[model samples]
Target: MIEVIGLTKRYGGKTAVDDLSFTVRPGHVTGFLGPNGAGKTTTLRVILGLDAPTAGAVTVDGVPFRTHRRGLHHVGALLDAQQVHGGRSAQAHLAALARSNGIGRRRVGEVLAEVGLADAGHRRIGGFSLGMKQRLGIAAALLGDPPVLMFDEPINGMDPEGVRWVRHLFRSLAAQGRTVFLSSHLMTEMEHTADHLVVIGQGRLIAAEPLRAFADRGTRQRVTVRTPQPAVLAAALTAAGASVDTAPDHLAVRGLSAEQIGALAFANAVELHELATHTTSLEEAFMEITAGHADHLAGSR
Candidate 1:
């Protein structure tokens, strides 16, 4: 239950986030995706109040974060994995945090176990590996048992086993009616973990909808049309307002449907042809939507 409206942030002459708006609903895992410099981190900063927005507003559960007396009880976040003190043990670290927040000591152990870090609770955080630290940060976030959770690249340093564990963890949390908002550049993880997706680019919102909805706009339908005069068939189809690109052995049509192109060929006194249709992939769909930003990102180098 979070809403960001017209969220704009700037640094010097560069706009980190420009008029971004979106809503995170309960009972679902919403994936926030974008290219490297697409203002994802800045948006999170504005939402968390880590950085004030130049223009716009963000609210948690319909109230501004500053007004909630016990705001953290309803919202938990893991902004960075390395914020823990290096020399302190995991238990001590969580205990210290719980004390400041007036949370019980028992919650420390509960979150430790929940994050699969119970046995490592007494170990020094400095000695812990990257993945272990990530788990520890997650344990801290869950210590409050909040209804809303925000994680920025939770799987960044995780191994395959840890990644799979987090996948199930987010799903289970959302299934229990929690709002899980995650921002990551990892497309594969988003494909598996996110029921809804909010994608942005160039500091602006791009598409926000069910993952399947964005994927259904793909243009990669494969069509195979066979004709006696292949060259003439290709030319006629191109003239009939179809994007005719030559394959190694066949023709690829982009705009016009195979049926329409075939009919045009027939009208032009062309011979009959065989046609077959194929489907594209979710990854392809993502690329198509972010193509302009992807190209710009590439050109920046």
Candidate 2:
């Protein structure tokens, strides 16, 4: 588990993360989501003790990460896949990290094969593609076989197969009762991968909740109904306190559920063709919550 309390970071006059407090528990894949400048990376840096917080505290399990006797054996992280020596082979890089952390050199081969990079372990990192570099980075993280994992955009530059493999890997890790925290800007992939979410905007917390609960928090819920007698059904729905809008061949209804709308149509003897509820997607809800929270929004003057 990871615990952060009243976390704040400031660079001179600018605050990057402000009064953030959250706990990432075990047995779940928790996603850290934010726009480009929302301070996701800054918070991760603080968690891993790469950067100190101006105020507040962050701990992995029970103590600050840097204070751990066997730091690499307790937590593993992949902040930047490209932050490795270009001249070194994949095996050499993992070997060096293992030696530094008092880990066994034999673990290097195990993780390389775990990440599907066993054959490429002897190749120079300079010759690897972006996707291969990502795999190599993951191999390094797992070299410790740590219980806690933190990754920043692990799927970046990955092909479809690689992306799918990563999704499954996260799930498998969490199922083993490990803590998995990943930061990403890809909402679609997150929707399928994360069990919980921590959303931030402009250096503050927007929401921290389960994925299903967060998506259901969307304010706009509508029921779509198709009927030949649109006018009659619309009148009945309006009388029941529902706002209705006309589409090409259906009525878009607010303030009601699909079952409610269907029952109203049936009581009014209206012929119904189709009835479905349209709940907001994760991307739509994310955009709505962070509407004006972006530090750098793109637009033409």
Q: Each model's C-alpha lDDT?
A: 0.84, 0.89
Measured by lDDT, the strongest candidate is: 2
Cα error, residue 214 of model 1, in Å, equals: 1.3
The deviation in Å at residue 114 for candidate 1 is: 1.5
Give per-residue CA lDDT, model 1, range 1-301, as digits (tens).
9999998888866777878899999999999987778888778777777788889899988877767666567778888998878999999999988887789999999999998998999999999999999999888888878999999999888999999999999999999999999988787888899999998888888998998888777546767776777788888877776777777667777767767876777788877657777666666777788878753232110
Clashes of each: 0, 0
Give the CA lDDT, 0 to 100, for residue 92 in model 2. 95
Candidate 1 matches the true fold with a TM-score of 0.84
Candidate 1 lDDT at 74 equals 75
Question: Where's the lowest-lDDT run of ten residues in candidate 1?
Answer: 292-301
**Candidate 2 regions with alpha-carbon error over 4 angstroms:** 295-301
Candidate 2, poorest ten consecutive residues by summed lDDT: 292-301
